[model samples]
Target: MEAKEIIEEKQELALALPLPSTIAVAINGKKKSKYVVRWALEKFVPEGLHMFKMLHVRPKITSVPTPMGNSIPLSQVRDDVAAAYLEEMGWQTSEMLLPYKTMFLHKKVQVDVVVIESDDVAKAIAEEIAKALSISLLLELHLVACFQGSAASYSHFHSPSLPMQRFQALSTINRTLLHTRTGSIETNSSRRQSLDIREEESFMSPCPSNSDIGYAPSQVSSARSFLTDDQSWISDQASTSDAFTESSSGSQVNINFELEKLRVELRHVRGIYAMAQSENIDAARKLNDLSKRRLEEADKLKEIKLKEEEARELARKEKEKYEAAKREAEYARECAEKEALQRKEAEIKALHDVKEKEKLENALVGPVQSYQEFTWEEIVSATSSFSENLQIGKGAHGTVYRCNLHHTTAAVKVLHSKEGHITKEFQQELDVLSKIRHPHLLLLLGACSDHGCLVYEYMENGSLEERLLQKYNTAPIPWFERYRIAWEVASTLVFLHNSKPKSIIHRDLKPANILLDHNLVSKIGDVGLSTMLNLDSSICNINTGPVGTLCYIDPEYQRTGLVSPKSDVYAFGMVVLQLLTAKPAIALAHLVETAVQDDQLMEILDPMAGQWPMKETKELALLGLGCLELRRRDRPDLKDEVLPALERLKDVADRSRDSAPKVQLAPPNHFVCPILKDVMHDPCVAADGYTYDRRAIEKWVEENDNSPMTNLALPNKNLIPNYTLLSAIMEWKSQSNQ
Candidate 1:
């Protein structure tokens, strides 16, 4: 059969079976005695045949007075009794089964005969009621006997043939015995009545005289022998008869009252014995009925248990099915997620390829002959999409990344394309950088206008500001090198301002814009703000405004909102001050001017630069001050004054060393102070006779007041200048600079 049909058939078969009846067994207030009774009933009663409810019986109190005058209220008495019973049974009295009382009245209570062990009064009352109702207890007992495997207990009472005849025989025996006893009592009473009547009749009628009867001694002797066993009773009776005869004047009276009295006592004894036998028969009948009910309950209980087991099995199977379906769903979800991830990766690659193709097409269509054009894909692949490791610098305008392209190293400046004005700036920078070419200026190798990126020759040493002020625990920038860098930047500025068609002013000029190559040569870069002036028109353009880094911006340009060559000079002056002081450009212009006016220029100089040429240092400082003048006309031009003056200082330093005696080039001796190993710097002799740089010795003495060479107290504690060694160092410095 199909599964569905099989299930239906099983259900139909289950319905055909009889449902077990529920039986409630009442326990009369005594819990300890009920345990054994409950156990036996439950064990022998099959679980599927019947279900048993164990109920505790509590007495219902009624308002009644005691034999004493005092009357206790029923509610109070009931509570007290309930509490005591609960204490004994270990139950809450409030939870007692109240319905059992009604069940008892309705004959729904299935109490066992075992209850007699705990409460005899209740058992006696129950048996009396059952007997009065003529309820057959034997049928119930027979059922219990079967379950208990003791059916033999009722064998004598049960008859195979003529089962109804046996009941009839019992009924007849009971009636006959009662009637025989009653008849005996009636006969005795009737004999007594007759005797009384006879006595009364004799008293009123004529009596027989003694002279009419002949005395027979032989008959009298025979009667006396027969009554010898009761001789004393007979003598008493005879004396009484003689007395009666004499008193009645020869009238004879005979009485046997003692014999009649003995007979009446015998009948009363027999009646009492018959009543006791009837009570025993009734008790046996109730016991039989109780056993029969227990057996029926056992059968019903067995059936119920079987049904419960089948239900549990069905539930377990359903749980396993649900878990299997859940696992399948989870597996399907994981597969879908993996597939989606693969599709997303494929889409990204396709997009990257499309952008690359578009850039190559644009390059081929509109190529700038001045420089090469790079595709965005080539740049991204080289720099790994501008990963943090390849990024060299970040700014408001753009990010600079170090990358390799076509076997050549390059710097990629990727401009911010979010703002509309930034595109104009990008084109302007590309225009300016592509046209200009100088050794001290950064070279633009290629441009990608579509992607807003500019490719240029990569500088190995980074920016001038980074080398001078950013590093720690490194040799300082020598005065000559600083002078060289300042001159190189000024020359680049001169070139930008002196171009043929129209001079370009580098609106933004600072140490950051000045980059350093592998050889530490200074290079000017970042011409995004450079604007070409119209030589034909003398008047300034109103569109041009004060736009440059703070502190580097000229005061005249800021106030007038005009672009001029002097504006670049003013910004270059700030860069010069930064080179000299090794401090940031912000507020350095005003601070330097104040120091120069106060004659504290030496105090503000970078000590790490070592001893400077005093006259040359003062001259450079004064030139920077002039460029920073508030009036644009007062500031010196880069081509005429700043560049020429810087070149003169470089020449003078070189000529002085050339005129001195030459010394063999070699590393400094081990005995020399490690701090003052540089050439042309101030050399001084301390108490330990160790030659150290003048500035280094002074700073050490000021901080520790001890000789660095010996790590001990100084005998002279003062540094005396070594003029001869200074002359030799100057010659060596000049050779190194060449």
Candidate 2:
């Protein structure tokens, strides 16, 4: 028969009026009544039947108990051995069977199956089965006493689709025992409520108690539903409380045939589970390694970028430094070129001056053959017809006259005697004087050979000595004019001393030869007694006859024939002293003679120069004495006497100008307020000693608090508000009140 037919037969038996623990069976139309008896003893009877005492008890287990004893029939031992084998395969057996019963009222049907379990678990099993079957009727559970022993009442059907439901139900039951109410397990009303009152024990162990259960022999031979080739037997076997329990020999035979089939299915499931787990592990490891490599690559990129930036920064700084150095080099080269240009210009100027001097000297020499000849006609023409008024002041040499030539005014000197040895020296004098044309020196325009004359520029004021001595009867020179004259004379002396190629010195530097222009610019006029300095030599010794005016002559140059620039400087100092004191250098001769004798120099100061600084005047007088020293070496040079004296005069002028009082006007009429007019016109305000009216201010202060109204006294006539005026008034009030 098929598995469906077998399942139908089992249900038909369960639905009978009553069911027994043991049943009689007939197979293949043979009257084998003993086979039923054997089936009862082999499959129906439970082990440990002697342990329970009930209404019916099994007298004893009469069969051979040892699984190794072959005396036990294969049919009786089959399920026991199978249970043992299942335990070795990691499954367990229950100690007891749970029983349940159900009645169909309309059909008057009673159904039951033996459930092996404890009393508390039997009620719960009955409820679970009733709910799954959608049964409304309450299940009635009963325990039965058989001839052999007391047996479980019945087993209820279980659903094959409830594996997940069963696990969740079991967890809820356990949680119920633990008193946790949050579980979501639900059951039909048919479930027994009494199970909640009776504390249920732990779930039963599925392992078999006896080893023989694992090694039992197979029964049912070719029972198509049991020892059959059909697929339904294995599935039907697992659907009920008896997952593989056999009700008869036919069922037992069916279970044995499907054992090998179930084994193959499980092995395939395990292989697939293991392969999936391995693949998951390998994928996880590769992902971790990839992540590590990516992190390292990112760091390397960052480091490279940082190094590139640093290199760029260094290159930029080097470029800036290079540019700066290049600019500095260019600047230095430009500076060097500028200095070279300046030096070249200075050299060119010096050469041009020397050339001009040579040209004038050649012009003045006027053919050396004519040194002894006197051409009166040519001299008259050169001197502009030698008119009577063309005569300037007469000198010891000859008549020195003014002339006009080439539209320029000039001075001419005509010698009285131009023959013999005197003629040769006179030509030398003319050559030397003509070559020197400095702003400080008198220029020799030309010589008059026919009239025995030389032409020179006319002096408008004649000489400084002549003007100062009142010889011209002109206006008296003011003090500032005199100081300026002094400065100009000193500057001229400095120019003469520093000329290149070293022009001659004027043996006479007296006031007579010191000529002034309209602006009072002085020049050293007559250079006839002059001698050209030898630039290459340290000293120039001239033993010629004395050629200078007696009063201004250097005593040493006369006594030792050592005429140097110092000899001229001494004569210049004497002239400066005469100018400063407004005294005649010749009159000072007597004073000098006395000073030289008495050495009481202070007594010699010129009375005309009143109230001069006595110390300065005395020192200057002493300097003049030193210039006229019996020994030439004792006198100060031009740089020491002239430059220092000029500097001192400038300092005095600066101090006097700085100290002079500044001009300020009186407060205007518009500034006069009606209230302040009384104080504004007060005598105190008008006095030079007071900056403002003191008496009116004093009267206002004496009034004390009444002065508050005095603010109205201030004039509103001022164009702008005078904060300074207000501040001064407030300060004055505060001081007076204190």
- The candidate that wins on TM-score is 1
Instruction: Tell me the tens digit of each residue's lDDT in model 2 across 2-73.
Output: 333334443333233121121211111123422332332343233211111011111122233465765564
lDDT of each: 0.62, 0.49
lDDT by residue (tens digit), candidate 1, 500-590: 6888888889888888874568888899887888766433554654577888887777777766888888888878888889997767778
RMSD of 2: 33.5
Question: Where in model 2 is the C-alpha error above 4 Å?
Answer: 1-387, 420-422, 449-452, 586-619, 651-738
Residue 95 alpha-carbon offset, candidate 1, angstroms:
99
What is candidate 2's CA lDDT for residue 10?
A: 35
**lDDT, residue 362, model 2:** 76
